[model samples]
Target: MTDQKKAKKKALKDSQLIVRIAGSERDRFVSLCDTLDTSAAREIRRFIRGFLKEHDDQLDGQ
Candidate 1:
């Protein structure tokens, strides 16, 4: 594969995070994602990236 193709195929995620929520809340969130034709992981990643970008300055001091 070309270098550009290899770069495109590389994994963007290299870490894991775990969160706990009430069982019913978890079920509802998963169901909502399914209804929207998306996965819970994908939604969480999207939210995290947006959140980080929004508050990047706060993180820069860490």
Candidate 2:
């Protein structure tokens, strides 16, 4: 397999996550994301990946 194909497979988003936040906060966040030409889901995924990288050691037990 080529490197590009391997990367495509690795990048698959095959999961669901549910989060609850105050309705007003969620509305504002979504509006900001739209203004930045991105979706809330995309930002959340980026945040999750960054957070995981930052605290990976703390998650080793899980």
Candidate 3:
């Protein structure tokens, strides 16, 4: 496979996260994500990546 294809395969989402939140909050978040033309999972993944990048230095010290 090509390098780009290999990277794309490596980035596949093969796992899941189950978060339990209030129904109302979940509805609102999904609605906002729809209005923004994005997905809840996409936004959550972005947040997770940014959070890890922000805290990576702190983690390396431990």
Candidate 4:
């Protein structure tokens, strides 16, 4: 890959989001993800990308 591509990929992976939720809810989510053979982070990222695509037009005026 080119340097620019590598940099972009690195930038995409560099950020962290910290969310505070009920401990029980978090445990349940983690268990479900484990059963599904995926990590919680992957599911959260998928949800975030889908959400952005769905609502991207709302940002046109902002």
Candidate 5:
């Protein structure tokens, strides 16, 4: 494909992070997980997406 397509592919692959939350935090995470009805990975991804949408520009200048 094109350079832009290749960049997009790389970006998608690079856009994931692995996190370890403590047990107390995990209890909260699992509560949100159940509310979202998704695996922990997905719930975290959804939260990050919404967070970034709301604060990306503000965050970038920090």
Candidate 6:
């Protein structure tokens, strides 16, 4: 197998989230993830970072 195949296979293995997307949305998200070659953990971290940046101040007071 080549590098791209290896990377995708590793991604399938390493991802931990059981995201329950279905049909076209599932295909679209998987394709987008594949294009980015990004791990699920990394994606979640990025999401959290963005969320924090947008809402950390509100969170602190609560």
- Measured by lDDT, the strongest candidate is 4
lDDT of each: 0.91, 0.94, 0.93, 0.98, 0.82, 0.77
Considering every candidate listed, which one attains the maximal TM-score? 4
Q: Alpha-carbon error at 18 in model 6, in Å?
A: 6.5
Q: In candidate 1, what are the lDDT values of residues 1-62, reduced to their tens digit? A: 99887776575765689898999999999999999999999999999999999999998869
The TM-score between candidate 5 and the true structure equals: 0.48
Q: What TM-score does model 1 achieve against the real structure?
A: 0.77
> Which regions of candidate 3 fall more than 4 Å away from where they truly are?
1-7
**Is 2 or 5 the stronger prediction by TM-score?**
2
Ranking by TM-score: 4, 1, 3, 2, 6, 5
- Name model 1 segments beyond 4 Å from true: 1-11
Q: Write the per-residue lDDT of candidate 3 for residues 1-62, one digit (tens) a residue.
A: 99999888788876789999999999999999999999999999999999999999989978
For residue 35, give model 4's deviation from the true position in Å: 0.2
lDDT of 6 at 2: 100
Q: How many pairs of residues collide in each model?
A: 0, 0, 0, 0, 0, 0
Give residue 2's lDDT in candidate 5 (0 to 100). Answer: 100
- lDDT winner between 4 and 6, please give it: 4
**Per-prediction TM-score, please?**
0.77, 0.74, 0.77, 0.81, 0.48, 0.50
Against the true structure, candidate 6 reaches a TM-score of: 0.50
- Using lDDT as the yardstick, the better of models 1 and 5 is 1
lDDT: which is higher, 4 or 5?
4
What's the distance in Å from true for residue 25, model 1?
0.5
Q: Per-residue CA lDDT of candidate 2, range 1-62, in tens?
A: 99998888778876789898999999999999999999999999899999999999999999
